[model samples]
Target: MDIDVKTLRTFCEVIRTGSFTGAAHRLGYSQSSVTAQMRALERQAGAPLFHRLPNGVRLTPAGSTVRGYAVQVLGLVGEMEQALRGPEAHPQRLRLGLAPALAYGEQLARISRFGRRLLPGVQLALRVMCTAEIHTALRNGDLDGAFLLTARAPRRSRTPATAGGPDPTSVAGLARARTAVLAERACGTAAQPGRPTEVLVQELEFIPSTSASTRPATPCRQVAVADPDCPSQRWLPEFLRLRAGEPPESLELGSMDGVHATVQGGLGCAMLPSGLARSPYGAGLAPLPGVPRMQWTVSLLAARSREIRDTHREGLATALRLALEHAA
Candidate 1:
């Protein structure tokens, strides 16, 4: 079967992600495009490759056989390309990932411009995903770098870089990464009002929802949280439990936007990073009272094993700082 490297790469991504939509997102292609590419690959192979399922695609027997050869072919192609282009040659592309919450506004535009300017001919690709996914991609070498939004410097963050020669799981190299304090605001309920402020918002009432008909007196102001895998939203539940002595009513949303919309609609309240709370994402949401204000840190991170030139690292750091400053 005749297949090109680009098509092979797309096939691998689909297999890796287990869904056309996910592969499209990672490759920056439309979902339909990914679907068409897979169909074409199947045509070439003269057999079906995947069994479509409600949750995700599963490989067929034919697909499993193709995968072994495809991997070998891709590895050989990579080796050929590397040999053709001397080891000392400059990198032509850099793939970077960002936490979903920080992937909006002009910050991305600013970073893109700076990246192009710094690398000259290098093509910079940015993808938005959960922090855990970003870390996984960096460790797998699918991403050259990432921008992470974390609650704050936890004790583990104090881990020293180079202690064991580039541990991807620990905060080793990332501890010294250039960090920006996104915002310091109260972590509590939000609703129609002005932007987040130093003061804890106390205007929200426990309005009961009609959906909770079984218990009329029960408060409908559920705690809104993003997907479980999202690092930025992970702290809300525990904080609520600590403040209220029990788990508050929760409304799990698929995305940060959904969480913000729920709170803005007066249906629920959310505890989030103060910076995200102040950005346009949290616009018109007032922080609730009782919950303490917390600081959120956004860091530009690179894998320690990746040999990024100091100039390139500084350029990326400067871009992030400038973006934050301009946003401010």
Candidate 2:
């Protein structure tokens, strides 16, 4: 009948990390102490919260219900603390992560400026990272949230599931692959609805470099960011194999600018976000016909244990959406 905020906090941490050991490490407590807190919490709730698993724990239905309330309770507690301390006494510091592909031109600067003005007393800390690193940082509680470029799920109406439907292995192979990997897995799991919905920001076209010569002597190479194995960039090599009729040679660049520069120099063609390809920076690039379009949604992913205020989170998402639009 009596559960304290500290217990709820520990419970949320366990859910965020998916293990008591991880929660303990993050909370600077002994694993046994975390175990005791969970047991006590279960006692207070009069039901099992999590089902023990070999690798980690999973929330039972009761646990899931408890978690929903726990998050709200914690948020209210946070708001109370903030209200009592006042904005000046406890300034909000949001550590946000972003992918390099989304930082073209002056977009990063634009985001920082807009975020500051919108939040007023808040400090916006931004880190440019690859998709994989961003996900990892979010899980580990190192970042408050992240803006990722995710592939949009195909509309149910647009998707055909009837008999004699389009072959899954046909020309739309890359599109199907992208949907399975990026949309259903990355974007789908990253943000839950209501708390902070994923905002559709931009659509990207993965174009083959026009700079490639038509001569057979000049083979088109696949250009990608250094961390091409991440979900967003991972499909490029496969796309090339399907598009070019062979496993094309690949050129890796550390930054999006470098990739664009190399591709424009005719070294190779890279899959580019539409924002970058359509910008003044991409003046020389031409869109590849018959290529399927992938829409990117900016997901606001934060540690469930440390929820950003709903207003603040939504405002930041709006700022990002508008900033990207202006930059584009």
Candidate 3:
């Protein structure tokens, strides 16, 4: 049977709020109207969806099943609405994501340049998050694009290099340069044949139960913190791998500042992006020899809509490219 989007929304709202009155208040609808909508949905499904108790309402088995589907449907519909509204109508809010530590230095300054020159009217929103959150935001249409440290795109196809040469309009120029070792002085430390010198690595603590694919593929000693829900924690392990191997012993810390302090104390080594580590405000830490080097690429993404004006799309692309170049 065909179920109306409105009816499903009303059903989901009632389930979410636990009562028709609560849903009505949240949706700005009259209590009677909300009840009618729920009743209509039940009739369409040919089942009593909710059991009305004296104090509240409980979802029946069928109602619970339908509610699950309704949430997905409503969420997609909301995303579609936002996607169709061009950047202009939406004030061109660019939701840019970056690896936690990499959000500092010239990289941030370059992004600011794009917002000021290319998209003067657009609102640029910067988010420092793990690779997983950035990917999930792009897939869900919450982010315009992101600069990631990986070689590949997590969701969309990679933009090709320019035909004649590297496209000046591409974001590749802004991609971080991978270098072997970053040190103030070159000291010759004779290479030992077999035993790999132990280096300190910092670990990011991510929320538990997150998808495995989103986690970095590296070995690390897990550390427990008061609030394990922080996103920076998830990225800590990967950042550590960029310079050293998994830490043997885990240290539970309260804040990011605390994590940095712990690393500075020489209690253990921590891995941080070059852009972040080399920032003016950075804690002075010497880069040890045999450290691994890596880089992340940032790109702008748009939907394939013929109706979207070419000038606007190209303008956005140019701004993003220039921003990356400035950062480089």
Candidate 4:
């Protein structure tokens, strides 16, 4: 038997509110209309969905099964309607994420220009985010794909198996991810003159205190990090404190450019992706001492499933690859 969409919706609302009266209030319908619609729905299904309790209503086993299918149907209908809204109503849209360190670089502007030129009529929006947030958004379906910087998970982010399974979209647990390595660059500590030239990001560990082993060779450095939770360098403060065993003095700057400039000005030092550290923009700062050489990987990642396998996605990925190669 065919089910009317309106009646199905009313049934779901009734189950949700646990009372016909409440569902009517929520749906802006009268009590008589709600009862009538549900009665029609029950007649079509040939089953009584609710057991009338003195306090409220309870779903029969069949109602429980139907409720699951009702949710799925409604979701599909919503998707279909959105798709049908057409360019006149809802323009084709894609949310592309990039780490701020990458966003402020030549890559983002170039890719955006190229996308506008190549994919006419597509609304390509930019989302600047930390690598971790980018991964989380990708998993949650908030972002379509991104140029994400990959790094090791911080100590606090790790947990035992029982706590929860790894989030599927997280970089560590990314399974159905289709990706292309956009670029590979090492991260380094930004230094002033006379500071070490190639050390690990955890600089304070090399310096010994009263309880520690050796004194710092250079001046105790001030570190500058980005303030926004989504900025590429947001992880620096934590990484420094945890890995270095002793935290250095840190300053939080508003933007990635601010962090770069602050490091170059001899005001403080910073941890930077090699791309940023070596760029002409960062010429004033020197590399820290001792080459720990941890490579920061930049990748264009999309969900492996049905979310992003289409002409627009393919075009965006291709545009990114070509632009990055030419820049390199």
Candidate 5:
């Protein structure tokens, strides 16, 4: 059977949005074009795909099976395009995306300067966005690499690596990206002040259903967080759950800066990166103890494929480690 990628894409989009018109609008194709493409696809497959309906379309049995194949085909095409675009030579620019609130003040300055020193020819284009978005761009070939947060840290009690290189991971997936751990930091409690200097993780239970002595009764127990996609946002609240096992109240914010300001205002305490906790921004907040440590690893992700891999990756990773050390 013969089918074009565009036809398969149209089929998938129609299944996704459940309407030809919706898929056409989303894909910037006319209704006739989408209909013709679907017709072509169905002919190639020798089976009907979508059952036309009064409200929205539904996938036929054969279409359901083909939908899975369509997804895999499209995903592979994306991976191939992304992998082939990566080249070792002096790139137009090293587009590096990072999570927002990763570093501020002095640390941020050092990151930019270090990039210029290490990657001379390529312009350093640093943009701050959520880690998930950074990862997506990295996978899509829009970025050369990214620094994103990962929760794959050593189990609590601060165990050191036994030996060897990072427990070895294979780089396989649509991204075809190689990842290296740049730095590791645990999540620590940060608030305005007036809490115990050394409270166990369990002691956070005392927080909910009670007001801080300094803060308002209503907002005192709230937990501030970055985007929901963040590892810290997902793990911290669960780690610091109430004695009854219910998640505490939360105040969501778009950036870490907003979280800090909210905390300073006595609205809540947030789970901040331990490295940043030691920074000037986290000046006074005390780290809680005895928690099943939620350690976060800053990972350097570079696009990698058999044909072309970034040559400057190791040098850039080294520079990043040095900058992080200086910041710490």
Candidate 6:
């Protein structure tokens, strides 16, 4: 038979408190209300569960049997309620997608703080992917939210818009600006030959590749070939495509550390973020003249339903807004 939890609770409370008046007081109900509830419970059980006695009220044999079950059931119900509402309840899991470029700066710190403050019990899952991949994941529901580049005003229309319309004013816009400023400062410094400094520009050409052989070759330069899969490497072809002349010739190295070592050895320049360049490695590197500024934005994406409860999405957006204000 279908049974209401309230009925069970009222029965258990009356038994524990030993009187209808006491149960009403503990449950914040009037004694009359408590009496009515017990009457209802007795009707449901098809028997009078309590016997009126001189001292107070005593349980009949049937009442005593049901009270045992009621106690256990009510105890379980109370525990379940507390578990759902408790401060120590397990956090909801949230998946967050981010572009490699934005992961390097204050975004990380801001997001961390936002999580600690706003979503204390959230389990954050971070995925670093390219802009295209992030968008795809968001559409597929594999990602609850993402930070990627946006080119135009976000519209509610079915067709997704392209990138690079007017400059954005959203949280993503601020991130782009911050990234651009960092890129500009990091790339502006041109490296001198035989200097013990770290350079923060991407190595566009590595040893006899199309980029290296075609670009205009500079003198007194050492170059290291980095992994093609690196985000820094992905930007090189585009950088060269934008340049007016032939690509420069240079050595190809595998890792970021190798490129740093090469630059430290006074071999050639390496493109890097200003935060990294200005850090310990950039001790002596100076900005090059006329370095083009480059910035990218990361957008948030989610289905309507999943997006509603996405704590990370909200937290990231808040953090992005704060970062933009501070950067501004």
* Alpha carbon lDDT of each predicted model: 0.54, 0.62, 0.45, 0.52, 0.53, 0.47
For candidate 2, write residues 301-320 as lDDT tens digits.
55444447766776787778
Assess candidate 1 and give its TM-score to the true structure: 0.48
RMSD of 5: 18.9
Query: Which residue ranges in model 2 land beyond 4 Å of their true spot?
Result: 1-90, 151-207, 212-219, 230-232, 289-293, 305-307
Predicted structure with the largest lDDT when compared to the true one: 2
lDDT of predicted model 6: 0.47
Lowest lDDT 10-residue stretch of candidate 3: 178-187
Query: What does candidate 6's lDDT look like per residue over 1-328, in tens digits?
Result: 4568887787767765668878888999998988888888888888787777565575553564465456445545644664587666646656666554444323444454565577776655555565555545654557766554343322221223323322222323333344344333322333522111121211111111111222344432333434332333343332342343444455655334344444544556555444434432243344322233234233454434443364545665666545434322
For candidate 6, the clash count comes to 36
Model with the higher TM-score, candidate 1 or 3: 1
Of candidates 6 and 2, the better by TM-score: 2
Rank all candidate structures by their lDDT, best first, as comma-separated numbers. 2, 1, 5, 4, 6, 3
Clashes of 5: 0
Give the worst 10-residue stretch by lDDT in candidate 2. Answer: 153-162
Model 4, residue 162: distance off in Å is 38
Q: What TM-score, computed on C-alpha atoms, does each candidate reach?
A: 0.48, 0.56, 0.37, 0.45, 0.50, 0.40
Candidate closer to the true structure by TM-score (higher is better), 1 or 2:
2
Report the Cα lDDT for residue 228, model 4: 35
Model 1, span 194-217: residue lDDT tens: 212121111111111122112433
Q: After superposition, how far is residue 54 of candidate 4 from its true place, in Å?
A: 88
RMSD of 4: 21.1
Error of 3 at 303 (Å): 5.1
Off by over 4 Å in 4: 1-91, 117-120, 151-217, 227-245, 304-307, 323-328
